[model samples]
Target: MKVSIDTDRCRGFGVCVSLCPEVFTLTDYGYSEVSVDEVPADLEGAVSEAIAACPEHAIETL
Candidate 1:
């Protein structure tokens, strides 16, 4: 699976970070940032949950 975050739509809620710290982090500007554009096989479930929990709907999976 591939994941992408829309930085403009992100609110830095940290939900994704809490759910999947391995893949997400908080930027200095206070927005949620993806550590990588592509989701690794082992982290698919966590990443999917993060996508679902995103309040701003800034995460997309492909």
Candidate 2:
């Protein structure tokens, strides 16, 4: 699965980063961004958690 973060909807929350450091990261400005183009099988669960935990609902599978 591929994931993308909607920056406009992001609130600089660190939930995604905390849940899936391998795929999601906090930008220099503090918003969350996707670091990987595709989600690895081993990390898909973590990414799903991040998506569900994101308060802004900014993360989505593409």
Candidate 3:
């Protein structure tokens, strides 16, 4: 699965990063960004958790 983050909607809460640092990361400005273009199968569960945990609902599958 492919995942992307909506920077404009992101609040930099780091929930995604905290839940799945392998797929999400905090930018220099502190916003959460997608660290990978195509997510690996092993990390899909964490990615799903990150998506569900995101208060802003900024993460999406592509």
Candidates' RMSD to native: 1.1, 0.6, 0.7
Off by over 4 Å in 3: none
lDDT of residue 57 for candidate 1: 97
Clashes in each model (backbone N, CA, C under 3 Å)?
0, 0, 0
Task: Please say which candidate is ahead in TM-score: 1 or 2.
Answer: 2
Question: Which of the two, 2 or 3, has more TM-score?
Answer: 2
Residue 48, candidate 1: C-alpha displacement in angstroms: 0.4
TM-score winner among the candidates?
2
Clashing pairs in 3: none
- Candidate 2 residue lDDT tens string, 1-62: 99998888999979999988999888889988888877999999999999899998999898
Positional deviation of residue 51's Cα in model 3 after best superposition, in angstroms = 0.5
TM-score per candidate, chains pooled? 0.89, 0.96, 0.94
Global lDDT of model 2:
0.90
What are the lDDT scores of the predictions, listed in order? Answer: 0.89, 0.90, 0.90
Span of ten consecutive residues with least summed lDDT in model 2: 30-39
Ranking of predictions according to TM-score:
2, 3, 1
Q: Write the per-residue lDDT of candidate 3 for residues 1-62, one digit (tens) a residue.
A: 99888878899999989888888889899998887878999999999998898999999899
How many Å off is the CA of 60 in candidate 1?
Answer: 0.9
Model 3's C-alpha root-mean-square deviation from the true structure amounts to 0.7
